[model samples]
Target: MDFRSLFTRKSKSSSIATQRLQLILTQDRFEVSEDSMKKLQIELTEVLAKYFEFTMNSVSMSIKREGNSYVLMADFPYSKTNKIR
Candidate 1:
């Protein structure tokens, strides 16, 4: 058994677990529920669909903590041909 391989594998696994924990903690800290996030995404998609021809997958939304306030961030991929306006 190679000792170095064990350390390397454990480090990679630990890093991923740590990142996931941090994400969960941040989400909890902001008190943002998964259902609410999904609802927001659906509503935003419906509204944007009126003016754009893009797949729901093209829109991405996330909540970011900025100082004492939470910021809602959204990104939409737009193409000239996809514009309904």
Candidate 2:
């Protein structure tokens, strides 16, 4: 019996399942979901459009770990070159 192969398969599946569970729990705590995040990005683009110009994928946001806590961070590729006035 190849115990190594059995152990490898078990661990791989376990790791993937664990990661998925963590993602679900984290998203729950944050009160957000993948669909909501996409909607938020689109809405933000529309609202910010009146003041700034940015192409598709120019803005980004995500929840990430920083030290011991998770944070929702957003980025907007900013430029005053094409500011709407």
Candidate 3:
């Protein structure tokens, strides 16, 4: 084994295919356009990033139907490396 291999650390991020599938599912379930969804995500990310530390693609947004209304749910997982200053 190469000595450098032992010292190198790899980031175990989610697969691109899985992420793409998730985006498609979210858009289809919510009846949202891909462009609109991405625009909203980016705007929200900009606002929240000012206060909290989160990875760009880690944010998940979904719409849930509740009887006569729908609820928008957003989840932003904090980044382990970026801390509040």
Residue ranges of candidate 3 with Cα displaced over 4 Å: 1-31, 79-85
Error of 1 at 57 (Å): 3.5
Q: Report the Cα lDDT for residue 74, model 3.
A: 89
On TM-score, the stronger of 2 and 3 is 3
The C-alpha TM-scores of every prediction are 0.58, 0.51, 0.57
After best superposition, candidate 2 residue 72: deviation in angstroms? 1.7
Tens-place lDDT digits, model 2, residues 1-85: 8767766645577778988876676567568877886788888888887777867557777567789988877788887685784
User: Which residue pairs in model 3 clash with each other?
Assistant: none
Candidate with the larger TM-score of 1 and 2: 1
Instruction: Encode model 3's per-residue lDDT on 1-85: one tens digit a residue.
Output: 9787688686235566777776777798778798888888888988888877766766779876689987789888876676874
Worst 10 residues of 3 by lDDT: 8-17
Q: Evaluate model 1: give its TM-score.
A: 0.58
List, residue by residue over 1-85, the lDDT tens digit for candidate 1.
9878876745577778988776576567657886776777778988999888878857766567789987867788888889795
